[model samples]
Target: MSSFDNTHITALTDLINKAVQDIIAEYASAGRAVPSLDTLESGLFQVPEETPARLTKAIQIVEAACAQLSCTVAPPGSVMINKSLEHEEPACLLVVTEARIADLLLDKPEGLPASELASRSGLDTRKLTRILRLLATKHCFKEVKPGVFANNRLSMKLLSSDTVSSIVCLLTDESLRASAYLNETLTDPSERDGGIPFIRATGYPFFDYHKTRQGLKKGERFPRAMVGWGDVTGKGLLAKVYPWTSQPANTTICDVGGGNGHVTMNLMKAHPHIKVVVQDQPQVIEMAQKFWAKEYPGAMEKERVQFIPFDFFKDAAVQGCDFYYIRSILRDWPDTESELILKNVRQAMKQGSRVIIHDTVLRDAVRTPESSSNASVHHDVAPEPLLPNYGVARVRTYELDMTMMNLLNSQMRTLPEFIELGKRCGLRFEKLYEVGETDLVEFSPI
Candidate 1:
């Protein structure tokens, strides 16, 4: 009959106020305007920063409360029922992209008629009108005038040249295939033998499928899409969060499996004094070279960055770097392969060297509250009466965990699991830098 109890409501109020003040103060200090929901750019999420960890945690806590409380107050089927058809949003998007409707709308901010959009893209006018109307219902595109379309912030990402378009393409393409066969993959011997649903649906494991001459372009699209995903989702905040300057001057930091050096290049750009090595498979290394030369000419010209071909299982990691940094790398493999990769890094380390691992550390279903005395090592927990790990706010991480499972037969890991694996390679967990759902853990030589 009543809303949440006094304690829960009070906590939510405090968290909301704290987050508001902190965000305002953070921006004001930098002489910038704080974000607002009315503007699309401001409405986006960012990876949290330790400089304002308390503020970041406050934001996560209150947002989770908002979602949970809103739903809790409503009847079961009211808000929850429609989510069953969430896939239709993407299904509609597949049509938008295939027809390049977004591209056609890009220059027509005033809006272009559905008939003209159809003519340019070669779809039937009536069919294109229905599809755009479907998307416009969800605000993906705006119907500026009846039966006319234009790019709004949401639809802009689907433009032909936008990196986020690549992300949209990859997930819908991959996730749709995997979802269809996921049930079969679990019980069918042949499907299980294929290793994952992506393999079963597409006739190859995710990576191997990407490398086929046909797969090469889509394979490349996924990484570039990651760059966009990082931008939108706040995965790019590491350059600011990491204590890069703590290392001595001229220190070397090796980016293991650094695809196209997107993350590594950000680090090099931000911390100019450090040297970076971008290592990956030979093909990726070649691409990384071109990426650096094109985007960060100063890095190669000044000898501050190097690209080297590498295979983690077969060779020792680039030797004697002060730091070995792995971002979004280890989760692609299961523990056994993960161990071998770490052992290689272990062999490369000098006496005082460390490894910086940037990955999601899965939390317990029920967790020690962040306010608890025992929570120093725990990931952030949701306030009770909401799921402990924050329910839908954390949907993306769980989705990613499944993405790893579906494509690679791997997963996101727990901190204890990380500890167990680290012990096998003689490394000790040194510290955890918490920022939203992701944690950057430092590992030192045993």
Candidate 2:
């Protein structure tokens, strides 16, 4: 097989392995004997005529065991039990909630008792414990014992006081507001006014709202979360994706809609020879200046970077920049809005200038089941397809896409969709650079 074919097979195989492992773990945790490999292989080949009665019995047994163990395994009444609601949890909620906890822990640094934590959060002790317990399962925190929770690496990243905490807050709030009206929004497809999207849900566009609410004060933790996320991930791009080493000295790089200039700051730090213009709204620019002054004082004065206030939807003010960098900005917009943003960037560029887009390009694939006796046994006794096309991978991507749709009415673009969007904006799409899991596409003026 060709390398591409081999790669696909390997990815598929790994996914299957992981799925199997998860199944085995679930069954074992429930105190059930695993099924034989022969039974599993036979089940894979011969589709079951009905939902396997044995599998149902096994789940019941497991659920009972879980109850006896007093474990918080999802109950039949839990939202996860309903196939439809399984993915409704907002991604931003996860980010923001974790960030809030992180912030609370960071303030104390030495860790607070459960009572103190509840008091500080303005949430009841019981409610806080339940939430923390759930988060602990995901490693966001560690339950020191029955009643207390401590911050972990993931939770630390989300702490509100951390520079990145703002991004989490921003995303979480935006997600929550949008999710509140998801059902209504979906029922009315023809509605031009996105009722609960970031722009409509908040009564104004995100940037405008941010203008009234200053950073760290406006409770706009989501934007800050996004900026922090970008900063952490942008470094990976610099080290592995962007061709920073090849770029000429005295190069002017424009960061379009670059909120708070965190990404630009990192880029300039990596490539000191390159000059940068951090562009955003007037209010955001003012905030960005404060951030730059505080975080990167002498570097800005040295002429390595300057903050410029310009709306990307308007005429481009980024003229003569060798690279127009937009990271994690376009994903929150629909095709029409994305086109406008790209058009502005195109107009600002010289012939050879590159438009570097750093965003997640989700793909359709299934997760593999792991190689374990429990997994093999569960597969043998389980019904065919388990959850139909509703495996872990599909559920994850679909849920995230749904959240984006509800909040911004935006859809995650496939590679081809991205190319088409670029074409619509009169930019020629070039090769894609893979940085970790993100796809960084380079474009030039057509």
Leading candidate by TM-score: 1
Write model 1 residue lDDT over 1-446, tens digit each, in one string: 26645665566566566667777777677676765322334232343432366556556666776766666567879777766777777877877886788887766778899999889988899988898998888878888889988877778778777777877887777777677677788988654545688888888878788889878878878777786677556665776666777767889989999888887777777788899998999998998899888999988988999888989998899889998998888898888899999999999999989898889888666655443444336455565655777776677788878878887788898777888888899899887776445788789999
Q: Please provide the root mean square deviation of candidate 1 (C-alpha atoms, Å).
A: 4.0
CA lDDT scores, all candidates in order? 0.77, 0.62
Task: Please give, for residues 256-375, the per-residue lDDT of candidate 2 as tens digits.
Answer: 888888777877777787888999999999999999899988777886778888887886856888888887788888888899999988887887898988776654333334312322
Prediction 2 global C-alpha lDDT: 0.62
What's the CA error at residue 22 for candidate 2, in Å?
A: 19
> How close is every model to the real structure, measured as TM-score?
0.83, 0.62
Give the winner by lDDT. Answer: 1
- Model 1 clash tally? 1
**True lDDT of residue 372, candidate 2:** 20
lDDT of 2 at 445: 86
Please give the lDDT score at residue 279 for candidate 2: 92
